[model samples]
Target: MTGLVIVGHGTRSAAGVEQFAALVERVRRRGDLGDVEGGFIELSRPPLTDAVGALVARGHRALVALPLVLTGAGHGKGDIPAAMAREQQRHPGLSYRYGRPLGPHPLLHDALEQRIDAALTGASTAGADAGTGLSGADAGTKLSGADRAGTWVALIGRGSTDPDANAEVAKVARLLWEGRGYAGVEPGFISLAQPSVPAVLERLRRLGARRIVVAPYFLFAGVLPDRIVAQSAEFAAAHPDLDVRVAEVIGDCDALADLVRERYAEALGGDIRMNCDTCAYRVLMPGFADKVGRPQRPHDHPDDPVDHHHHHGHDHHHDHDHGSVAVVGGGPGPDDLITVRGRALLDAADVVVVDRLAPQGLLAGLRPDVLVVDAAKVPRGPSMAQETINAALVSHAKAGRRVVRLKGGDPYVFGRGHEEVQACTAAGVPVTVVPGVSSALAAPALAGVPVTHRGVAHDVTVVSGHLPPGHPDSLVDWAALARARGTVVLLMAVDTIAKIASVLIEHGRAPQTPVLAVQDAGLPEQRSVSARLDEIGASAAREGIRPPAVFVVGPVVALPTTGPTV
Candidate 1:
């Protein structure tokens, strides 16, 4: 049977060492693997060589070495592998298969949720004890739905120099926030990255979160975890009104041990698939361009007996090829409305060129290092020239970075997405178009105004009203539209609704035709105004309805209350 060696980046703290050993014991207790041992590359206790030797002494020549890390950083990608290579030299005939880092896994997410729940429970108990005169078990209970909704989470990770590793933490935070009923979840680092523990906590407070839980995304008790707690305490003391609680690290639990076993099995089965798309050493990320194609070297451990000689001769020359660009439709307002494919692309993107009407909340979940170019074209205000935006997309894709041009609603619906696509194609860059839920249809539907009804309206026409009815550049057949009995949905027509209404009425459409204008449709601030075809322009203007408002005309506008069955 192949033995398992759990490789860890050793910590200075004795507690951390003990916890790591406990986790090893937990994994060993499973009994499927004949022999299991764990050791660190640097800092504390039984060095990697010791663990390898122990397994070797136990008659286990073939071994599976799994990195006990949340992300594939320098330690997992380079240091541990380099150290294992040295072991192969020492043992002469020993062989081992390296495993991928164990993180962004479902089991780890469950473990984090448990920790967060515990923190909230403990806080609830403390509050009960202070006021309700309750004690012990009676006081400790799960927080109510209201309490959970009011609280925000700050996921803290032992930050790394690798941008890819840091991004993994942000990804975890985003995953944790999904469907968990928290106010929000933001990622912060204990070291080596931006938005430190205190900084994230302050941000949470500023966002109107009274209760905050700082969940350390660590595997065991370590100096970093301790520091996270201390920093949280200091911040809590400073802002006495804020209820800040620190959740414990994911200590030696069965969930973690199970994950280790799974990793060990994967390593033995040669199922190791590392995500290199966003790796700093492979991808040319912004602010970390120097790391691209960089060679990996062994970390120097002060406690190790071997005389470590730094090797700089081994160089890896990777082809920094151009990455593909994705024109993703961000859907109407809410981030949750974005398509699964769109969200996935955004998650993998190195650069996101965002439009003004796109889901802005999605930006908070992106990696802190990602370059977000605000390509927002504010109505009648500052706007990014379409040429400049198109050039930016091609340039980023050519630079070996995944670029996402995030547009609001459907990219094809007057979003000028095709123009950008042509630019990318001209530059020899591959581009993909992911369709979104357009506000043109979504706005009217959300306002209880269906564009189509079996008996009420058989057809619906969508038109852009950016130009007045009589403008020289206008292509809309006002007379033809007026003759049609079907519903007409007008987008970007808020500014010139009066002229369009007059033209429609003059062209034989009834002046008293029911009209519904839905503004900021499918959003929390969504509001609707109702008037006749002739009165819609004046009514919308008087009600302060702005651009992005959808105007639905004809019998279908009143279908929600008194229209066809289907």
Candidate 2:
């Protein structure tokens, strides 16, 4: 029976020595060879010369020495071979052969794949923590492949001095990315790489990646791998949004035995026989002797298997002319008070049809490429008619482009959003409406006034003061509203403020009822004036306030302010 000897270049770092020990333990567990042992070449106890001398004393001949270096250059190429030559000469009667280093092998790719699988699939136990839970199906629920797309694996290792050594590790990571269908694969070093593991994880978070797994691309358990794992754990803990897992270190499996055997075949002889019985002896290797052995997968391809013959074709469809129009309600005057979605639409708009009500400062967020068309621009005196504005909205949509109709407050409340939607629909174009924080309510609230209070008022009525024509009818029946002890809010009533206040006072309503006029509701220029129903008209005139203001009146207006304190 032939004996196998695995040799590693001993390092001063304790982590490096532990990695070598783990590899030797793995090789010893494989029950295929007669004797399996490992020795360190330098910088460590149990040096190669002494170990070979001991093996020769045991009468083991035809010993195959394998180098566990990650690269074929440097120590594996020169120093280890030179040491073997000196050992063979010291033991003149012992016959020996030296094998190649473990680099650029499909087996290394396999090891990486296994690490990824373990990190992604999670631990075997029901509630094991380290696992990322990447199984395609779990508990009778199948997960879509796209759902796992953002799952990333970053291979972190101790940087190599040799450029070729670094390239080899990077190449293995690339192969694993393609083979496993990962969303992204990145090669990082604890020292050398531009994007360290932490930097890469930060970038992944910005990219909206939900889960990341760090696979240490080191052979045996080592110091650097431990540090990298610890760093990965700390990074994961900092970000609760991302799930992170540290995978098992490479070269801790017997499949690596096949890698060592293949490299040996490339060195001294050729490939080994498939059957273990044909070999000289069946021996136990380290890490491979689980009493029951980790249960074999029922179906190795638990999910989709690679189909070499399966081909797909790209299908081209007709160019969609679904012209989109963005209707934004620029709430009162404040830009930040607008919904986030509304702002996004306005920023990307092709054409922004702003009215006289929208604040000019809020329009600064529009993209430079956007075409601003002021539909309500009173060029000489007054703006375009309502029918003309509606026609313009229909024309923009029919041209197959984005149109943003910026309005003030809730578009439906007084901005006429339904009218624009109907016009777009009639033109066979698409329309999306983004509701904003209506100034009708925000205005009163920001002015230290609550339209509804526990006992003061249980109901509120909102109406436009201007009638469509001269039929002399307001939306709210003033006679009926005067009888109810509720609040009343008015929009675009500045021109008729004196008349409305007189109407309420004449309808058997108290002239001393609290009234609040909130101007520029949410903007920096916001101002609020509190007075009685009769004094509101005089107070507003004194303040020189104009239209686009909200008027609120009722007993609820007397409630204590809920706004910020001085």
| Candidate 1, run of 10 with poorest lDDT | 126-135
- Model 2: colliding residue pairs: 15-223, 19-221, 28-285, 28-286, 29-285, 29-286, 30-285, 31-283, 122-131
RMSD of each: 16.4, 26.1
Leading candidate by TM-score: 1
- Tens-place lDDT digits, model 2, residues 174-221: 887884667887787774324567887788778777777788777755
The residue ranges of model 1 lying beyond 4 angstroms of the native Cα positions read: 123-140, 309-566
lDDT of 1 by residue, 1-566 (tens): 89899999877677888889998997888898778899887766688889999999898878999999999987888889889898888888999999999999999998888778777776331111111111112324656778679879999998775788999999999999998888899999986666899899999988998878888899877678878888888888898788787777888888888888888888878898899898887886654543456565555455567874521111211112336688999987877889877887787777999999999999999997899999999889999999999999988887667789999999999899999999998876668888999988788777777788888899989999999988999999999999999999898898888999999999999999999988887777888899999899889989999967889999977654631111
What does candidate 2 score in Cα RMSD to the true structure?
Answer: 26.1
TM-score: model 2 vs. ground truth: 0.43
Candidates' C-alpha lDDT: 0.82, 0.65
Global local distance difference test of model 1: 0.82
